[model samples]
Target: MSTSTIVPRAKATGHHILRIRGYSHTKAVVATGEHVVSCGFRVNGRTWRIKCYPNGSTMEHADWISVALIVEPEAAAAAPVNPWFSFSILDVDGKPVPEHTSTSYGIRGFTQPGCNYGWAFHRFVRRFDLESSAHLMNDGFAIRCDIKLMRAPSLRLEETFLDVPEPDLHAHLGLLLDTGEGADVEFKVGGETFAEHRCILAARSPVFKAELSSSTAGTCVKIDDMDATAFRALLRFIYTEALPETTVPAVARQLLAVADRYQVARLRSVCEDKLSGNLDKMTTERNANSPPVRAQPRGHHGTHRWFIIIFWFMELCLKFLNLLGLRRQPPRCSLHHSMMSTSVDKPHDDEARPLISVSTIVVSQRTGHHVLRIEGYARTKMMLANGQYVCSGEFQVGGHTWHLRYYPNGHRPETASYISMHVLSTSIGATEDAVHGKVKLSLPGPGGELVPLCTYHNNHGRCTFTKQDNAISFDRYVARDELEKSSYLKDDCFSVRCDLTVFVKEVRAVSLVEVPPPVLPHHLCQLLSSQERSDVFFKVGRKTFAAHRCVLAARSSVFKAELLGPMREHEASCIRIDDMDADVFRALLHFIYTDEMPTMTSEEATTMAQHLLVAADRYDMERLKLASEDKLCRHLDTTTAATTLALAEQHQCPQLKEAVFAFLCSSTANLRAVVATDGYEHLTSSCPSISKELVAKLAAAL
Candidate 1:
């Protein structure tokens, strides 16, 4: 007989399974009381087989046919095989026959030849049954065995799983806010007091830690410059790590100050984030109506170096006027110095019938009060003789830029002695309708007093500052005879003071999209945080919520009329709302500011939406009403269905009404309740048509 050697396959791990085909063929040669072996199959790169005895393999079981599986030439030099296997004798269709025996169990080291182990199969099948069974079809069969070895456990340095436990720190801290159970300290702010834990405050704030530990901390700490509401919000944040939107912006500045003073880093960070992220930023641009009369041009004159030069030039002019033994520099109104843009005193002229009348300068720079006083009047006097106009620094007055043109000697053909001054609107191409201002020009007298020289006042329609016409003039403004007098021109440096009052109506391009400012961190949210800082208060039953009047008026027409109308009710800046819950009002305020409905379950959201819907409808806030209506429509249940239907009927919310009808009709339980509730009666009176639909839906449900 020729033998075939089994070779190892590539890189497989664990035990190998082998099945012998036609395993029953050896039955013919298996004697009734003799040892029998079948052709082997390759297993783990080695041949293995079933060792059987037609009778018993051992004398003790001679009456039974025993079965055993063994390695043919036992793997003496190979790695140990720890295996579990099962064997089945297959029938004609390659299926295990019921009558045939199957063997399976653990085996020890099977290295040497004949070193075999297997399940003891005594009386596995009766001799008669084996001979008669299909397992021996044509005296031949197949045996299949499934064998698996536990994969070798390898030592590894890398982690196979990454799940680290984290402490639920904030949750525990949040519990401390309501229960000052271990609080050892109290604070007094305004007339109110608040309680807090000493350890927590000390841990969160270094200032608090030091102050509380000091000898003087035994007494109740009085917090000055901070209100009770703001202090309460601060304390809440300290304990809970969350800043409640109770009092803000109005309280924000105070709270920020307190946080800073306490050295509470996180509290400061929260305040900064709330203030910066959600706070309103006041714009620096001035109002456009009555522009700044003394408002100087922004670009050219803002430099300190140029201001210094202007200052020195005015000082020299004053010195020259003093030396000439003539009238001193004009009253220090504008040109002598830069008036603190807010000062608006009229130029003080000595004479009753003054030549120049100076009134309030334009308040904002956007106005047309562009005036420039050029010194060295004597130096420019030659320009008058040469028939050339002397110039003043360009200034912005009203809505247009202007510069003065002075013909020192005269504008006349003959050698005349008249001084001519003209104001030119620099923006000649501007399409502005008209710009008007009261122009006053005067000379400074001795002792810094103004000598009125020239004045012109007109309604906004006077000298136009539009594209077509741009200049206003006083030709032959003053005779050279009058100006050269000591009182008028002193030290060859007569100072001119021009006062102007202006009005400008600027037309801006109309935009179709009415883009309201971004409503966050909401100004109303800040206002809500501003408790005592608020001017308006809401008494929802007994609970009070302080708010700003501007915010209320801006949000609701009903509130505007109630708070600011001719027949107002806010005598004490308080509105009493008896029907709505305080919690619901709080939710309403939040919605007004953030436009975000409160987080609630479907049922709670629906219930609250009904009340909010009614409040919104009563307040004439269509947006809030629609928001509440939408929320109710989305979460309609039996509890809110009738009330929403009533609100929808009252507010004409067709979608919400339809949603409630559909929700009620979907279940008998809701319909039964809707019929029993008074809201349905109100709905019927308010909208009989909806009642008819509900009646039909109810009838159909029955």
Candidate 2:
């Protein structure tokens, strides 16, 4: 569809015309607040399409006085030859009035010259702030004017959720305001006092201190004698250190008043920096919803609470500033340095700010979006949005360990908690009680270190413990068996063999030593024993581990020929295995017993990579070698890859070396990723035999 054309006729050469395109008016009482202006009119006309502010000059022209016209649909062709039109004036109630009514239109008088025609309302004197009493005409027709104007206009804000009216009791601890003269006004539970040296007090318990005194009082600003605008700003500062994202210096300067009044120099310093650092931020941003500045407030004492409120406000501001990456590295105020001893002053500048004092903070475990509401003692409220709450603090809840920390923005994150279990049993064959023992329960960290998790002392009930080969065992050590079973043997015994070794702690393994058939009759043996309950245990080396009640055994269903049987039938053959974690070993044990593998962990997967390389050489398990190589290729790191590459080279695993070299070559551009794939020796040495072109590409990239 074609666009429609709409244009206006241009004015002819040098012609002067005054036209009001639209008229809007409001009737308001005169400044006297008594007499109202009725029939207030404005004319509507246009010379060109552009509009300008209204005044008397444009309305008084006689040439266009009656020349204005409004086209009716019936007379659509052209402008009317006779354009003059007039309409009656009406009051606010729309009541029509006589022409000679009391309403006045002219500046001094309503009529024209003594013997002349009537003078129009537009012929009045110069501009005035007051509304004019005029009969406004447009296209020779009268128009109405009754628009309303507000006394004041502004952007409004809602009350913050954290708004509080009184100071918090907890904030009373170590709360002292500097009083100059190397002293502070301190308030304790008993009463208020002035002192230079403050001491710590244990009002709570042995580990926790109830009270702590500052080396020096907090920063200060004088607010009592300041104007309301300054006083109000000071209050805001106490709650939010940095002013709003856009705060004027004039407003920030008031923070000095708050700081001085509350004696919080830190807040005062923050205000000074905010005002000084970005002079143009506030003006350009135009944040009109800022805290209101009281025009006039009675007395300074009643405003005493403003200082503390200002303190928290400043705190919130600092948090916001830090979040926005605008936090300043404030220089030590000269006065503070002068007061401190020579030794203390320098450290103060170099030392990191305390965690609580730092507005920009990181917590562990917390993540995503969250809003924090902090209500200070002074009853001031501050709101922070989009902060991550991480719980770095560690604690034990319900026998589970949890760590708390924060994300960068202050959201909480998921926590990892672990529990410990101890008693285990191994079952072999159809025998009910095969092997029983006490074992420590824990998960190994990345370094293959066992972290003491939880301790579960199992007595009876059957559970399985697995080791090398197809060996399986079970524990039937029931708690009730302690009272019913009796034997001549002083110590109980069970037996099983395991090659794996682990770091040992307080928990002991069950002793599982085999026993010969009893010589005494069964009925007589039971009667001769002093105690009824007897415990069976597993034995490893000289140490004995116990199985309390029932002995549980772990057993595997299938057996296969030893892959390395031809090469080494001797059990004494020794081989070194490095970089393997306990979890992988555990998986191997589980596989031997149940023909099933344990669920893998990331660290275990790494260990599995190492195990694969070792097995490739010792047993020549081609499938295992290929599987380990594939895992290594997928998760190759510099350290592990280096070791794997070396082992592959030593074992003459050409395919493994080729895979490692390709990975190394492909990642050369990523220095860190490549270095992390640690097989530098392979890349420099064995890699050449694999691919010369890849080596060259890697060298060029590197």
Error of 1 at 276 (Å): 22
Give a tens-digit lDDT track for model 2, residues 164-194: 1231211211121121122322332123233
Q: What is the per-residue lDDT of model 1 for residues 54-155, given as tens digits with 9 covering 90 to 100?
A: 666666666556666665443343655555655566566655655564545454455443434444465555556656666665444444444443433231
Model 1 misplacement above 4 A: 1-519, 664-689, 695-702
Model 1 clash count equals: 27
Alpha carbon lDDT at 221, candidate 2: 20
Model 2 misplaced stretches (Cα beyond 4 Å): 1-601, 620-623, 648-659, 666-679, 682-702
What's the CA error at residue 319 for candidate 1, in Å?
Answer: 43
Backbone clash tally for model 2?
126
Displacement of the residue 156 alpha carbon in candidate 2, Å: 49
What is the C-alpha RMSD, rounded to one decimal, of candidate 2? Answer: 41.0
Give the CA lDDT, 0 to 100, for residue 194 in model 2. 30
**Model 1, C-alpha of 444: deviation from truth (Å):** 77
Each candidate structure's TM-score, on Cα atoms with residue i matched to residue i, is 0.26, 0.19
